[model samples]
Target: MSLALNIHSQRFQLIATAVAASLVTAGALAAYNSVSKRERRRNLSEEVLRSVSNEASVHTLPDYSVYKEDASNVRYDEELIREQLARNYAFFGEEGMAKIRGGSVVVVGCGGVGSWAAVMLVRSGISKIRLVDFDQVTLSSLNRHASATLNDVGTPKVKCLERNLKQIAKWIDVDCRAEIWRKEEGGDLLEGVDWVIDAIDNISTKVDLLKYCHDHNLKVFSSMGASAKSDPTRIQISDISHTIYDPLARSVRRRLRLLGVTSGIPVVYSTEVPGDVKLLPLPEEEFQKGPVKELGFFDDFRVRILPVIGPLPSIFGLNIATYILCELAGKPILNPLPIKNRKKLYERLLRDLLHRESKLTGETINKLPIDEDDVGMIFEDVYLGRSVIPPHLVPSRPALTRWILTQPLTPENCVVMEYADAEKHVKECSNPTIHPRDIWGEDVNALVERRSEEVARQRAPA
Candidate 1:
């Protein structure tokens, strides 16, 4: 009987324990669902509020219907516009501000780099901008894009820029072109723009656009290879011929040179040698499928994506914007210092030239008439960093030597040559009887004279 009673007690206790555990789990689940519902409601409420705010902002923009034909002519409240741009006006002053406000810019490739450039340009008082891109905003773009949000996904990038930029400066004209810029139709797209910003990533397209701009005498600024670059200090603005330590610049320079374009294009590039980062590899199955180039959206576009840290492209954009703004304000950066210690190279070249001259003249000369800066001008600006001889190859061991030994060392007489070529010229043409034309041909002499005269005119008082 007692055993039966104990068995009943154990059974009752087990039932109670099971019922208590079930109640706890059910209560916990109910609480969790309550919290989850609250979170969902809160998120939905915030999203709705944000949407309403965006709509309100759009509606509040100054009415531009009167100047529909030319939105740039539409006048806004003078006090509001000035207040919006007061900080910029303070720095650039009235005339500079006027120039900036009147200037128009066209930004191609509205991606991480171009988008930021467009935003800053608008914010800085640029009255007109044209955005050209044939891409859609993806989920991944939000990290680096200047104004894209989750809501902007699947929208055209140029349209996204237009919508946001219009909100930033109600009076500004934002022309959105949602088509690719082909060489055949690019002229129409770029027509009447004060500046063109080339933030294109595709190598062939970039080269084509730059060449087109060069051919048409368009004022253009290009951004080079911001992917996989992190160091902001390494960024620089220089003519394309002088760009160094950048693979994109090197390839573009070579192609442009082949097309008879050696220089005169300004570019923003990173001097930092790329690290171990590489283009993302294609899957093995992709190789099994066929040629990788065939898989690209278009021929010559990169099939593989580059690994980009979000901040690098933004920095590049800022640099481009800063450069363009200064230029539009008529305060161009005439002498951007190359970060790779080019001054040391110039100094060394000067020393080598002095030594070579001492050997030829049989005098221990401590100095020449020209200084290191002159040497740099002669080597870079005058000769375009190549030998003034047949083939005009970029010298492996570049040396600046006197073109005419009889003439004293001066900007007009100095020339760039290979170290060995300089030595050979010293040995063979050092004689008072020999003329440079006899050895280097009359064409070289004429080229040198033309370059010298150009330099002379440049050095003359304005």
Candidate 2:
């Protein structure tokens, strides 16, 4: 019994020793791995943080010392500036903001897109912006235009925009020119600008500016007609050279081609003419009648007379601002992604699948032949969205429908249906029919009275 007990005791002791040894080995290995992993993690984190911080700070605070010493360089209202910065960071990653600050931008028009571009550029901490416009504030410009007000009537656009920009950033260096952008002066004006944004409405001026930019190797973006449309989805930023079969873009391309220009110019444009084209000039006689007194001179002049409500210039202005932000920040969030990926098999497969589905669903649309008898009437009514021939007029037979589709009708409504095309149509029709100019006209007498009061107040005070 003693011998058996001694053997059992010896076995238990050996077991205990083995467990301690195993535990000691495990602990040593764990300690070595923990130390190595911690060192590696620290090195990696420091490298990444250094790269991002160094790039981002160039556009951000730069240095804490610089921020503290100069009250005028940064907005005194730090909270507001910080809020705006945070929003900007959300839209453009930190690296992008750095690029924006490092670059210089010039805006060629102060109306609609130009105004918003100016505001956005300043808000993004783009230290320098040059604004060029030769127009004056008018009663009709109160809505979509930024610096337009009852008091700003007849005031130069540059001065008005300057005042508003001052409120946004005290340190911003805004170069305002109260002169039209002349092609002759293009080289000098665009010398140091990293990018030029074309918001000018005049076709000749647009062509000249584009050619100048192309020749100078300066990056430029031009806005297509934004006055008559509202669908924001159809609007995109792309190289103008590749845009094909679009009417507005076609016109621009033709104009550029006439100047012996080739493709590859960047542009921001919509694919369709807006449905709310009623504001456009009805006829030469009607247009010659001058501004409607009720509508005011500026309002009558700017609104193209048409039937459907269309895109207000304000919406386009906002879109223009967004594109500028994307370009400056080196981001590419603009839709239609510009046709740079046509080679991908997945994309082709998806397109083929869509085509097959359309065929199966009877969604393979066929163009109806236009009948000469109904061309004018149908064409006019098409803009109004009420079919000239009522749906009830068609016979309730598949054969009749097929015959209608096959028949040569002069007033044929050829419908091409696609998500992108429909979106473009809607964007072109985004006009907020509300007129802010009417309010300005109503305040004219009050404005005169206020001026008189101001004169009296100044005399009394002095």
Candidate 3:
């Protein structure tokens, strides 16, 4: 009787436990559902709010097929098109397509880098653009520019690009400015525009435009000197402030620093300084003294005569385009505008790796050459409220390479018994990496000068 009573009590206990577990699970599921529903509602409300806030009304949609036949007429490689579209769908979604069709971009220059950048923008479905340039197409410019052709030799670059962009998107609203951008003219080139692309060649002119764009709170992406460089892999999307060694970047940073601005404006620039010899038209006396004082801005864009017109600029230009697409779609590729390097973490890892390797190998610790300026400055900036590394002077190879080698390696490139690759090395040595694309500013005046040039593009209202 006692055994039967025990068994019955045990069965009752099991039943009660199972019932309790089921009730708890059901409660959790209910809570989860409520939270999920709330989140969904919030997201929908936000999307509706955004749609309503946009100047281009959510009601008036854009036509995409206006230039489809024209693009088809260009006979682009079908396979390549598929590959690019598939890879970049994140930047060219249906909504992005609508934005491209409805939106407008003011291209500041129609030269080498700008020409291709404009072309990529149009091909990516941007229907409306204002092409601005003060110069006519030159034979020399045609060598590296995409908007120039034999028939376009004497025509203004803005006009030629406009014609091409129109051919790609027939209904694209195009404005041609056959003059430079200035601050005093006080036109609406930036007004009612979605974004700006800086492809201008002159340093002073580019600086003025950047100031205007910054002041107006317009999104702008500027290309630094792309000439006289051979390594396509080195070209990257970095902040004008973070780019290292290159003359154009240095000049840009100097200008920004002079203006007392912290940071704004995304840029595509290179760390590899141009190493080519140029014919400088300096004062006759100055020319004879030494190889004409290397014209900093001019030297930055000078390229060596190559055996073939290589894919370096084209590839870099394409990368710039990809970043731009990311900006336009509101889905950025690298954020905080231009990517900032994590020098501190890199240093820490190198030191730690070196110390560990020395202990294992029973050798004296070798001190890695640390830049007194960089080490102290980087640490203080990150720790205290000191300014971050100027974008133009961001550490690249040689300096970076020196810093890395300070860590003791086991003869091989291994990081002291670790299987860390280059990417892993960077990851291990970085602080929280923020998307570099969101570094837009409310005050455009800080970065760009308005109406400095007499001629600016003007677009008719839709």
Candidate 4:
């Protein structure tokens, strides 16, 4: 009995020893992994800094140690603005709205996107904002810059935008910096700012600014080449790594990657083919008065002389502001994961916009033979969900059903079937009558399912 007891005691000790050894190994591994992750992040940051060293060397940023507490004294009418922001209440709730109202942003480069984003942030209850730009409004900027008009021609863009931003929300604080934020100059601009909105057009300047933001761990968002795009349907918000087609995004991404940064910056860009684009030189009379020409570099810069569309830049600006606010509010942002997978980014945004009515008119999606190439001719976004009409098939509207359809339609190719669509078909018939629903046949279900599967596959994250 004593021998048996001794064996049992020895086995118990062995088990405890094994457990202690396993715990020691696990603890060491955990510590090693944590240190490794921090090291990787530090290395990535250093690499990107090296990539932009030349540009960053142009100016030393001013010390930020002195002004961090300056924001504490800035006055805000929180109660009044909260009442005005009642619509946002549904999105962010009272506590969240307060966070937004107390937020601050600095928009660099007060051009088309910058000007518009500034106004959006103001109206969304951002109390403090700083606008920076060296360029003044000119004859040509009137075509694209939303805040500038003929009366404001030759005036600094930041002041003009600041004026417009304050006019909407009188309690909001607007600080205007009209000088160029040179790569070598002071970063006093970023002091106490919660977000830095990068609306810069120059690649070198953008690289420098991005490097600073990454190094400081500042939350920054950028706008990429808004010029020469015509498709209003293709504007998308995505990370720097996932962008395609836009030359500005490509340049920024390539340069940042060389610096050791492969992701973490979100950008607003367009993927649509710039249709019928031709780069025209500044008309001689306009060149003398143009804001773009005021920059010394424009004497030889051809890229800056590209076509400027009316609303495309504004769309990018609006999207950037919306993404920032929505993310802050914890609303579902159309995830950029789709863009990363080479799937339809803008089309998904279009889909979200057109989701007003649930059921679409059968005529909107006329069952027909279609080639993928014919997508442009057959599909378009309407007040209801986007339609896929076949030119060959005529439409027929049924009488009011007095009920809303609860069945969800295919999200990819959906349009609305309104209960009151009969009112639109009054010209076709003297009497209101319901027709027999046409059968789509067996292939219809299979086709929809197949397309959905394909979309699902592409949409899944890598």
> Largest lDDT belongs to which candidate?
1
Q: Residue 247 deviation, candidate 2, in Å?
A: 4.2
Q: Could you give the candidate ranking by TM-score, starting with the highest?
A: 1, 4, 3, 2
User: In model 1, what lDDT does residue 247 have?
Assistant: 54
Clashing pairs in 1: none
Q: lDDT tens digits, residues 145-260, model 2?
A: 76567888899988899878876666677888888889876676676888898888765677889888887788887776665556666666667765532334544665687688
lDDT for each residue of candidate 3 in 12-54, tens digit (9 for 90 to 100): 8898889999999999999999999999999999989998999
User: CA lDDT of each candidate?
Assistant: 0.82, 0.57, 0.57, 0.63
In model 1, the worst 10-residue window by lDDT is 294-303
lDDT of 1 at 39: 100
Tens digit per residue, CA lDDT, model 4, 62-110: 5544333343353434555566677887778877777787788899988
Candidate 2 TM-score, true structure as reference: 0.52
TM-score of each candidate?
Answer: 0.58, 0.52, 0.52, 0.54
Poorly placed runs, candidate 4 (over 4 Å): 1-79, 282-304, 330-334, 340-462
Ten contiguous residues minimizing lDDT sum, candidate 4: 376-385
Query: What are the candidates' C-alpha RMSDs?
Result: 15.9, 18.9, 22.3, 25.0
